[model samples]
Target: MSDKRPLLDTSDIESEKDGIMGAKESSLLMTGITYKSTTVAPTVVWYGRQLLVRRKLFVGLLVVFIFSYFLIGPADVLDLDNVDSIVQVHHQSNVLDREVNQKLLLPKGYLVYSNQCRIVDLDPYKREVMRHFKRVSYKPCKQRLPLTQMRYDDHTRRYVLSINSTAFQSYHVKNVLSCCYMGVERVSESNVSYTHCEHFKSKAQISNTTDSVIVKCSTEKGQIYINGHATIPERLQIRQRLKQWKRRDQGRRVPSVLMIGIDSISRVNLIRAMPKTAQYLYDNDWFELAGYNKIDDNTFPNIMALMVGYNLSNAMKYCNPYVSGGLDKCDFVWKLYKKHGYVTSYGEDAVKINTFNYLKKGFKQPPVDYYLRPYLSAAEKLLDGNVVLGLPHCLGFETESEHVYNYALEFARRYRNDSFFGFFWTNTHSHGDISQTSSMDDYLKDYLQRLLAQGTLEHSIVVFFSDHGLRFGPTRSTWSGHLEERLPFLFIWLPPFLRAERPEFVKALRENRNRLTTPYDLHMTLKHILTLSGRTGKLETLDGAKDCPQCQSLLLPVPLNRSCEDVAIEDHWCTCWSYKAINKNSKTMRHLGERVVHYLNDYVTSFRNGSLAHLCQPLTLQGISAAYKARLSDDDPSQTQIYWLTFSTAPNQALYEATVRYNKSSTSEDNVQVTGSVSRLNSYSGEADCMNDFAIKKYCYCHHKSG
Candidate 1:
């Protein structure tokens, strides 16, 4: 038989010997083909070269295609469309139906004629409203005045008062709310107790004579100052109550929860300001929810959403916490934990503008087992007047942020053996002006690191978060900033044991790392935590309701395809991109603006039935400020138009943005048919006041004074 196997020449043999070719590779040196070790060897040139050319051409074509793709196809792929649109469009206007003012609904005892006043002028109206203030014995107020400290002195037969008065304190005491008073009652006697009270004044007299009087000293407003804790008998009763509480919580196996929050910080800003800190958290088994969004525009409403598991608007006619009896009787989430034997604590730095009491009365007594208000009150009283206006207002002796950190740390340390729930929020570093929040990043990170190292959070569910992004700054004008306003940072650290035991949960959490989440979802998660207690220690799988209308627990699987409307976010504040605006002066744009104004007026009228509803003249279009076209999703081809319009109503003008959707078949020449009803995006009410140039500059045109 003829030998059909390919023969290797000396060069092929050498190539094989040099490990350049295996037996199969050396087979190419057949039929006049010779393979060398390095140089391009003579192959069956006609056929081999043809194959080689084809392979090279294919690769060359791919390279060129990829290069072209990177050059032309990526022109605006990464560029944010909104940023360009913001720069391209300048002017748009809104036309709204005139609003008529009926009778203004005032809080009981409030004498202001119009409820729209931003800041009340108290000097002229104090006497008129004081008589209407009825004193009702509610919970004791834990807040302390800046200068006042009261300690009952048995030997002196009086409560000793030491105060360092400041201008702010003087203003707060005399002008704001009800004046302070001091009263005393015997610990034993309920009916016949001697009470002596006086309005807080810089020059109030106190009789410190040598007379034996055994009574508990407290404020007429039910506030107990730092030095004025309950008497010995009252202390005994409290201890007894605590003992009863301990017995009630006996044998329970609830895990602790620690929540630390900063105010007015967006997730984007947090990452920008504290990249190292953000990374450290992710590296330390803490999961970040990138899509965590604020439920409301401000802190109170967002907090109420998280604490109560409900929409802020549903709870009250207005978004303000103070409008509906102030959260004193709101039955917050902490109360649920407290009922279940958890030692709950609620504290926030910054006393005067305390969110729960802003423009409203605060809680009467300690809302939680460890209330930080009184402690903060004491610290503020001791801080120097000059330093109070600046950063690091003294908390005890430390800065306000430091003090809050330490308080939370110490509480966690003290309650390591017990089930506890503690929430500490500090606005001292990041409240109204977020310029200084970057400075706080290091301190906050270091504190959290220390907590992690100390294993203080070993058995606890820890949450680090913020309320919302900055609302009042030049940044707010940018498209990124506008979206950032609704996106808050949320990071949760689950215990290793729990995570390991429930791999499904770990998977769900990992999946939800980029899913849309809100404060109401947090409330539901907290409810899940409540169910994790008891000796059985049975942890139910997280509620996996994909399209929960009200709330969804973090342990649950949130659907990848969820809309803001499905999550209870109103159209005005929904951050989801959905609308695109038409041309600035297009007839369609003008009609859309008019429709938005009429819609807003009708919605406002629905809520406000009295004279308060009709407070302004009919809105007329000044100009269209900007417009955008929104694509619902990558797969959705239909687009909706959104317009930001400046509207003037007699003496006042405001900026309102609205989204309008038109049928795809409707042509510009034809009367456009509405595909969906017009929805208002947001309304900047005080933006374009005719009287204020700053407001006009921000939201209205100062040149259009005649309009």
Candidate 2:
């Protein structure tokens, strides 16, 4: 104590205290804090610095965690299951950034409203249509190992059959695989039956007289029989067939025609479901018809329009598909092509639901030189496959569609140098779930690439097209679905030489893309191909569609003012008109729905000369589901106000959709006529088991079923 008093004076102590106070004040000032002298400012400043350091560390760690979560998360989180998932993710992102309200402006002053019909690829409403069904990837069944295999020897022009020893051993059966060839024959237009075994052998060299053969495999004893297989021996019988061509001209090069048809796909759906194939087509500068509308309700009418240039009424009158040898009498364009020295081939994947053979007489004779019906007819019975999405998915080791493609490829390869016309239609894969079309993308792209690599397209015209959109599905209920069902995908590709020589035709096709078109125009286009030459000024004039005389080839420019009526497009199947939503619960809509149901009942009661009147119970309006009024532009002055109503019915709770015309100018009951066929929105399978008429089956509810 004595030393501290002596060592430090009062002034020294005061000076040291003042310096410490000044440092504290500076720290408080830097931190923008004003406090009384009694407060501990330095302690507060120290705590603030420590908290800031901790926050920075926490933020850095949080960001690292987020990055790791995204990088190491389950793949399904980012993987899109179908078109709907892709659209939803895109739509959600767009919603976060800005409002999304997009519309596709159609030609002739028509507008495709986003609120009504959304054909836009990324529209969120696509989710609504797709949500009804689960996303389905092609999980093909395991490859079925056959007891025998057939290989075609081009040198011998015969099929060599071989037995698989391993397959026989795996079954713990005898390796003695005896086989016999069942010859295929057309009994009648509606019937294709096979003959009994003619040449039975353990190892056989089959004749190339027939295009398809059913080879039955069994043990030598004829017991414990093995499954058989349908073989299509790809034989180039060009020398024999070319002898029929009398008007052969080696001087001029005519384009080969190849039509690859996929059933029940819309133009927009093409982009959504088969992006890779669509992109390949786009990248190759394929001419796509934006306004290619369907002419009628289903594949029969629409396809007939293209094949024969005839409407349903005219086709029934002229072709009469129900009668034997009636289709043979029809003037199909393929006949014309054949007469003009072109090798013609026609094939379809699904034999049961083939365009010509589905509940109708096919052809008394083979329609084309290389017909695939006999092969498919036999394959359906012998092949082991699964019925996926209500259609056959696989045939043994390959998908059903692959058989069609392989057949087409072989046909093209065989006739690459000749002027040929090949029509290959596939229904199994695309006709089912719309999402299943995605499975065909890479394969289709590869197919086209193969065609390109083989130089098959050097002097050829390829048409990749569809009949219509989904005719029966959960999608069929949406507004976009309505339009999609009307507008099918149509693409035309010309050879590079043709594109370079006939720039005018390419230009016209590009211009015609936005204009209204139909299968009638396509029929004319095929005819126009018959006249295409290396030297071009103007293509020769060909007869137009019988029903639609105004329809012309796609190589010519389509009129901008062209109406759906000009192209023979029915009002129900016309996509040129826009619609706006109306109140579904309103009195007017309710009455309209009732009227529609009444009309449906009357239709069933009067159908087929009152045949269904006794069998089908009368349908009553259960409730109105949705309603829309047509919004016609100034250009369509003659069109009356139309209403599209969707409603449910009693007994089955069956959904029905129809387009009704309400003429305010008239004072008659006929003013409210249904424009097109009344669509049954839901399945009426068991209820309509009594009837076979495809048209009446939709409205009929059998009296046999318990109420």
Candidate 3:
């Protein structure tokens, strides 16, 4: 081996100790090559140990880099801050895919009308109509020298009627304050009689007395000094009823139902007229029925559909308001609630044109346990009030609608601990002019806020809704108004408890917003509320509407392909079908207009056994003003083209709007038929004075006036 462990050179030892040397020298030393040897071995075994140490160090660094790259993730390793952003991007992509699928599944023209009839707040036509009604600052009537004040004492659980002595002192008159309990007596189905006056003591516990009372202060000379009306809510009775119900139905939880209704206000009009209230409802997560279509022309039939779940013909046959006690036989939803140990109440403003009593005999008996008609009637009769917008605006230093709201608030407060059903409607502000709806925006918003703050909505199902839109006005002529007139505002709120317990129902409600809905659906929803229980479980089966068997609870999903016929909505009132302008001068439009005019004339002639044929002048189409052809949906295979015509008739130059359906598939002469009743677009006040039939009056032009 020639001494493999040869003597180490002094310079090699010094260089190795210093860790510095030329590559060849270090290699020669490590490889054990002799300093005198000029040839070196190709394999350097001595340096293998040093090379292995370096290889291990490099492998350790490589492992650490791989471990760190995976541990921190590629985004983090690349110093990017979009980890959550990436997740959000995926989530948005999934949502978009879902929406696209939904759109693909929807039938054509499903929401076309809604998309086309978007009414902006500052629409030129609406603004022009608004100009007719000058903006008047709202001023609450000054409180008169108070004669009486009714309040509930929470601690005492009794209502206290306080006599205000200020009226006597301020007027410098001495009088005896005498109060009499005024009880409502249903003498007949169409009539109500107030009970004989019974002496009542002032500042006395009137909780046991009737709900309303008449108070009068007389001078010594027997001259009436002050007269006022007071309403005493029966809180004690409500509590008792609740206690009995709780015992009878233990562990069953039912939400209190409160409905606040406005007349002639549409979905978009509500937003335009009452922006604050709409925004408040939006912020509070109220579920809005975007496609709630009216079933009839005006409030009466529409409200009847909601309360009685009956269509016009069925309602007339079953719940004839003209017939004595007919409405009593009608299955009003509130009666169901009342039977189930819930305190029920009904109130409305605009006494003359009130929903139930407008030219129709209202309920003969007090429909609800707490009725507001008597008090409102007494107030309107006894109190000094002023008319605004063709209706009583104020009664005794308070707005007419304010009385209804106040009564509703008191009723809600009184029955806060009890299960109750209350329907309060106000028409004084919104019934006549659409612009007047703005006057009630702040007040209505405040009322809703108070309901929330006072905890009335804690366990309540509140519905803030409307009947229909502007029935007759400049706004009605606009395309937006045509859609808005049918799509009234319908917003519903479910309590937190119910929302958490019945998530499926809430989900269905949210989904039904875009589906075509009607008052019949609302009727089923009310019925569904009666079935809810305290325990978390599935909802019970609900009965469908009388007229519309397919109409179910709005708390349940409404079919996307549901049409006007599905929900018992007439073609005249249905806004689901999209419309496009057609040339009025076109021959087809002219023929359609003539057919519509002839339909109206025939409608008038057919009434009362054709007795009015001579009394009413035959209507001839003067000209077609505006014509639109309906864009049929894909599901409709009948090939029935619906044409909406706004045309003038001769003799009266009366403008009439009618919906005529022309069946292209039919070979019969009756292929063209009027879908529904004709709408009198102009004032037919004096033109149809010869006819007493309200339906015939729209089309009948008096023969005497024709000359």
Candidate 4:
């Protein structure tokens, strides 16, 4: 083992460095035209819009346009200082979709065209145009860089470096750009290809100890190239370093937990809205709990259940947050992980209207090591990008889901090796117009794939879940919609090794796919994971753990016929039963219909917000839409019979639905009890619009009359 490594020659190193630096000047000159925030109308024609022009003349025209754009100001052009404002203006104008080809004639040998600037390419080989930034450079051990792509001259075997024609917009700014030289010898022929340019960008050295060589050098321009070769031993060292850089925890057995939650998405709708993510989870052996039920309505109650295994009603009864009882002392599942030496963090996109923030007084201090409330405030007030939580309402880009995905990605990247529990809940996409979430399918797929590719999820239990279904959309009016409201999507991705080692557990999870489950079960699963990692550090052993009273881990057997009552699911929210529609004129329908109308009347009066006048005196039964038979005593059909009915009420002429339990005989005895679950499908008039501002407006049909 005596001196097996080869030594590098100084002469070779000197020549390599010289080739990389090319020709360095003592002081750099900025002669080429530079434009900062220039608004160039695409129709600006250089050289009379000629398809083909002399290279010399083309270059000269660029110089003139550069002077006009730099020295003078852009004429008759709208400034895009606020991207959203400009985009909104575009959105309002029908011309945004008119697809007008905007041409900005510039002096350039190669032609590039965009909707913003349309150019006719004169070159023999026209290239495809891409939207994102080109060419990204990073320093050693730096944070993740934005995804970038640069134009390449395949014939010249170099990067296209003309400042006027460069697509590297970030290079326009000194701070956003960096200079790097990769010292390499191509191993896998595929690895050397940059056709998928992001592949090249991803290979950029993100850490100080990475195999790829990167350096910072002062230069007058943005484009630079690397020139270097390594000795045999150096190449081996580079390989080792590359391998190590890719894996943050190469041999660690401990697994981390990363939960990315989407608000107001049901299991069925999750598949519809995010098919790519759904397929990805399925393809990767991730388990999906199809019957995952919500214990209560809205984000706060469901989140309370997921975090502390307690519903909002229970939490309010004991340590109520509405009464200023801080959740810092609450026995949340994250607290257990924190107690076991794990870093716990929580984040939600709309912190102003966050489940705990709006429903109750938010935490006095951060409940976790890293809470995102402050960041949300800063992002909303200071920075505006792909995601913006605006005032009154959190207005965001359609790519807001991707923005939240990036935050979670950053967290996982930062703490890849640490035992951590991080929860990220995003409401920007699904909370309001759930139709926008359909576009997030590919975004989510890409995010999960990136985590898997970067090895961030190798030692983690990742969950992509949601609170409940679309709560305020037209889809919420259907019978299936009512059922969907109680069913949220739950996808869990376990480490490959664990799944392979414990096939029984994986099988159990797959078995529980159609079995009824709840967020409390998720809590129980997390608890099992935490407890298994006791003093022995043996997490693979998950035996002898008892299931909580109302929750069962998906990793364990869950009885297929598990009732809603067994899982503490309130009767109103239960959708595990079969139902049949009775005729509108049927005796049962008449009784149930009357009960529903009376229930709506009582509900309106309960508000007492001056809607008493609007309250119905002679409640006309327009029609009974549908009815589902609920649990009844078979011994006597009249003994406490519950009928779920969708009927309409009058005065306000609004449509309402309710589950009413009543006992009616041939004599038509008026003994009816209204169930707590009452829903308003449609409101015809503003008569009962006073309670529209309230969160519980589903039950409020009262209008304030101003004298």
Best by TM-score: 2
Q: What ranges in model 2 sit over 4 Å off?
A: 1-125, 130-135, 144-154, 159-181, 189-204, 216-247, 533-541, 635-639
Q: Where does model 1 exceed 4 Å of error?
A: 1-253, 317-326, 378-382, 385-397, 535-550, 578-582, 598-608, 611-620, 633-707
TM-score: model 1 vs. ground truth: 0.58
Better of 2 and 4 by TM-score: 2
Stretches of candidate 3 exceeding 4 Å from the true structure:
1-135, 143-145, 154-158, 164-202, 218-232, 235-241, 533-542, 608-618, 634-637, 664-667, 686-694, 701-707
Per-model TM-score versus the true fold: 0.58, 0.78, 0.76, 0.58
User: Pairs clashing in candidate 2?
Assistant: none
CA lDDT, candidate 2, residue 360: 80
Q: Give the per-residue lDDT of model 2 (tens digit) for 56-80.
A: 6556645644553353231111212
lDDT value, candidate 2, whole model: 0.71
Score each candidate by Cα lDDT. 0.52, 0.71, 0.70, 0.53
lDDT of 4 by residue, 1-707 (tens): 11111111233245435532432221122223334534554543442243234445556645654553342222111112211211010101121112211222223321212111111111110010001101111112212222232223435423321222233443345543444433322222112211111123222322222222212222467433221111111123333433443354454466689999988887656654565566667666677766687877678767877778776656666556755446656777777777665666777766556777664666655676655555345334322243322322222221334445655676576567557788888887677544556556666778888999878777888888998876654555554466667777888888876777677777677666556778778877887777544423443453322223746667787775476667777656665543444455688788668766765556555544644435324355778766666533233434666667777665445566677666664345456766545666653335445443223455443534322
Q: After superposition, how far is residue 678 of candidate 1 from its true place, in Å?
A: 13
Which scores greater on TM-score, model 1 or model 2?
Answer: 2
Candidate 3 lDDT, tens digit per residue, 334-394? 9878877888999998777777776577787889888888777777776677888678987
Collision pairs in model 4: 42-103, 42-104, 134-149, 141-207, 141-208
Q: Count the backbone clashes (under 3 Å) in each candidate.
A: 30, 0, 2, 5
lDDT of 1 by residue, 1-707 (tens): 11111121233245334432332243343333335454455645555787777656656655654554353232112122221111111011121112201222323222121111111111111111111212121121223443444344546434454454552254243322323444333221011233454555433334532111112223445432322221111133333544565576665445789999988887756655554566567556576666686766577778877877556555454333444344556667788777766777777877766667654555655577766665455445533322432444544324576667876886677566667789989887666453456555566678888887767677889989988876655445334455667778888888876776666666666666656778888887887777776522333443322223556788877666566666776544555442333356777666666665555555444533533334334445666655555434444454433333323332334544444455545566323332222222234434334422111122232324445
